[model samples]
Target: MRGLLKLTLTQMKLYLREPVATFFTIFFAPLMLLLFGAIYGNEPSPLFGGRGSMDVSVPSYIGLIIVTVGLIGLPIGTASAREHGVLRRFRATPLHPLAYIVSDIINYLLMTVLGVLLLFLTGKLVFNVRFEGHLLSVLGGFLLGTLAFFALGYLVAGLAPTARTAQTVGMVLAYPMMFLSGATIPWEILPKGIKAFAQYIPLTYVVRLMRGLWFGDAWSQYGTEVAALVGCLLVGGIVAAWTFRWE
Candidate 1:
């Protein structure tokens, strides 16, 4: 337990020390929100059932932030560590493998939660957006979404042979999902074919679930999205665990 705590803190500190990671993980989402919100300024939209654009934009950016960390940050960090033999050195120690992986994951998750809070606060304070639903339900949806993406991150990290390859793979996966999964563009405004394609993407489910929870959409109506995210969590988690390598 002590070792896990130490590793978690160390991983967190390492992430904080990286300027790019610190900026994207902590600032980018809120900055994006501020930029778009300034242009759109709490305008009610028929696309989101007349809620302010910031409301939809804020939650979507939350998903984008998580995807950024999971799909790009984790994979690059893991592959770099592996390529540099950090994982091998850890294996030579007395610590269990789970401790190392869990610590890193938890560190990323904490950063994600912090990012979400910052984005939400910025949306509320600057754009006058408000959550119309229960806070706990929103939190539940966030946790589920985070877990699903974290598993995907682990899968990517486990499979990539080097940091460069991991980054290339992560970008290939991340960019399309960011644009098409309703993270940046409103899904209702997307073309029919694009919407159809988005239905198959895991990030789409996450964004929908988060948006629904934020707007007080009944949890009963979200069974399919919840199920899909849970399935991704299970499949990705198992594959990542099975494929993980020390060297």
Candidate 2:
């Protein structure tokens, strides 16, 4: 247990060591959210109904922004480490294998908190957005979304053939996720086929669930979205645990 803590911290510090990569991981997703929010941030959402348009969409966008960092950033970073022999080296150490994943998870949780707060603050200052939902529910959405996505990252890392391959895959998937998750293109605006395509993407509903929390929305409002997130986590978690390798 103690060793895992140390390993987790080590991976985190290493992540910080690459200043550019670190910055991209921490700020890029949020910046994209802000840019998109600024462009369409003022509009109403069709999915989240009954309230005004602006009221429902902001939080889901915020959640989408944060999840990208964890879901997208973690896999790329881990893949880089594995390619560079970091994971291979770690396996020879006495520490637990879980340490590798746990560390990335911890780093992302911190990133999630910071990203959400910073983006929210910026939204309030620049975009005039504010948190309106139940605090506990907002928190629940973030936690569950984080866990589900964290598992997704690990699963990606576990499946990649090499670190270089992981980076390529992460890059390929990132835009698809952002687009389908309703970051760049709002889900409602997409065609039926595109919307059907998005249903398979994990980040979409995770954002929906988080945004729902922020709006103080009822759970019933999120049936399809929550169900999708749960399904992704279950299937992805199994694949990650089964396929994850140290080297």
Task: Give each prediction's root-mean-square deviation over alpha carbons.
Answer: 1.1, 3.0
Candidate 1, 53-96: lDDT as tens digits: 88788888888998999899888889889989999999999999
For lDDT, the strongest prediction is 1
* Candidate 1 regions with alpha-carbon error over 4 angstroms: none
Stretches off by above 4 angstroms in model 2 are 33-57
lDDT of each: 0.89, 0.70
For model 1 the local lDDT of residue 93 reads 92
CA shift of 216, model 2, Å: 0.5
RMSD over all Cα atoms, model 2: 3.0
Winner by TM-score: 1
